[model samples]
Target chain A: TQLLEQSPQFLSIQEGENLTVYCNSSSVFSSLQWYRQEPGEGPVLLVTVVTGGEVKKLKRLTFQFGDARKDSSLHITAAQPGDTGLYLCAGGRTNDYKLSFGAGTTVTVRA
Target chain B: GAGVSQSPRYKVAKRGQDVALRCDPISGHVSLFWYQQALGQGPEFLTYFQNEAQLDKSGLPSDRFFAERPEGSVSTLKIQRTQQEDSAVYLCASSLDLGQGVDEQFFGPGTRLTVL
Candidate 1:
């Protein structure tokens, strides 16, 4: 069984602040995906990093895959009230269709 | 185009009752997945289907949980004798092709099930 742990289970910040969330695991994965979910809605994919040391930026969000593929991070720049949501990191193994997700981090950006 | 869709946005059932959740994947999608999300938790994989074939169900927690994707498009997850622990939001996702590497999955709003 693979486990993904997320740091800073909850976060609150004022508008324009920057925040970083971390996801770590002992097991290596072939791909890692970041998703943001708003209240009462399903998670929406933000970005996916496949290679080691890979970084992908989506507007105000930046996602990084660890060099060992065992960890990942999501950073939000100039956060806004609309950026508030539950952020989840999911790791996908080679040849497997299933994804193992982290516990998730809830972020609240106050305007 | 419409994204993946789930029916009965909310469901409340008595303990020991049987409940079935439905999922309608995007047209022409080849891969479909089901996940369970408990309150305040990330979604956990429950099952996967490649067209009409169930390729993986190892994530299912118990024998009482059953899922089927008949005709390769619409899928159903049925739980028998629902328990309090079964209360959770069930999500459905569909991808355009096989493999989890490149094809991005589109998710549905999910069905919130509450076992009373």
Candidate 2:
């Protein structure tokens, strides 16, 4: 089974601070997706990076996929209290519908 | 149109008891998936359905776990003789199509199951 490992399982920062979360894996993937989940709710898709070295931005959040397709990253700028939640990265393999997800990073932005 | 929705936001069952979880996907969604998520962990794939056909179920932990989507709209996951280790949150997701490229999956609130 392919495993995606995320760095900094927990993060706490001030509202104005910036943070970056990393997701790494040895296995290659066809596409990678980023999601943020709040308490009592399922994960909500933030972005999907399909091509190697692809990058996408949503508001203050930026998502990037590695050139090897084995890793990905999510960067949040000027974090706010509303950004406090669990962030997850998932990857989909070629010709497969299943997705392998990283453990997750819990971010807490203090106001 | 409504997003994916799951029934019974939470369930508590005794060991060896039988439990059923239900999922209602978005209208006209052609692909549906079920995943199990332990506390403080990411969701793990459980099964996949394309319309009424169950395409893959390799992620099911054991034979006691069974999932079915009869009409391709609503799906049910039943666990027989449930064990304590089977406790986790069950999430249902749906995508418009799974043809190629990236198919964004929309998820439901999920049903949290606890076995005593």
Candidate 3:
């Protein structure tokens, strides 16, 4: 099984502070997706980085896929209380339709 | 109605009891998936369905966990003789199609099951 290890299992930061969460694995992935889930809710797709060395920006968040496709990262700019939630990274193929998730990073952005 | 929806947002079952959770995927979605999430952990893949066919169930922890998609749109995950270890949030997701590379999956609020 391919395992995704996420760093900073828990994070607490003040509003306006920036934070970066990482997802790493020794196994190569064809595609990697980042998801953010709030309490009592399932995860919502934040971004999907497919190509090696690919970088995608979604408003205040930026996602990067390592050149080897074995790791990825999510950077949040100017965090807010609304950003407090569990952030997860899943690695899998575009067609296989299976996702192996990381342990997750619970971010608490205080006001 | 607009997004993936799950029934019985919460379920409480005594040990050895049987429980069934339901998932209604978004209209027109061709791919559906089930995942189990323990507290403080990320969601783990349980099964995947394409239309009325179950394509993969390799993630099932045991034979006691069974999932099916009869009509392709609605799915059910039935757990027999539930145990405390079965306590977790069951999430359902749907996508346009898995054949399309990198399709975004929309998730439901999920059903939280607690086995006593």
Could you give candidate 3's per-residue lDDT for residues B52-108 as a string of tens digits?
899889988999999999887899999999999999999999998763437788999
lDDT of 3 by residue, A1-111 (tens): 439999999999999999999999998889899999999999998998999999999999999999999999999999989999999999887556878889899999999
DockQ of 3: 0.66
Off by over 4 Å in 3: B99-101
Better of 1 and 2 by DockQ: 1
Model 1 agreement with the true structure over B50-105: per-residue lDDT tens digits:
99999999889999999998899999999999999999999999998784655577
The candidate that wins on lDDT is: 2
Per-residue C-alpha lDDT of model 2 across residues B1-116, encoded as one tens digit per residue: 48899989999999999999999999999999999999999999999999999999999999999999999889999999999999999999999997232688899999999999
Count of steric clashes across candidates, in order: 0, 0, 0
Q: Model 2: which docking level applies?
A: medium
Of the candidates numbered 1 and 2, which has the greater lDDT value? 2
DockQ of 1: 0.67
Could you tell me which residue pairs clash in candidate 1?
none
lDDT of 2 by residue, A27-109 (tens): 88999999999988999999999899999989999999999999999999999999999999999876788888898999999
lDDT of each: 0.92, 0.93, 0.92
Query: Candidates ranked by TM-score, best first?
Result: 2, 1, 3
lDDT of 2 at A4: 95
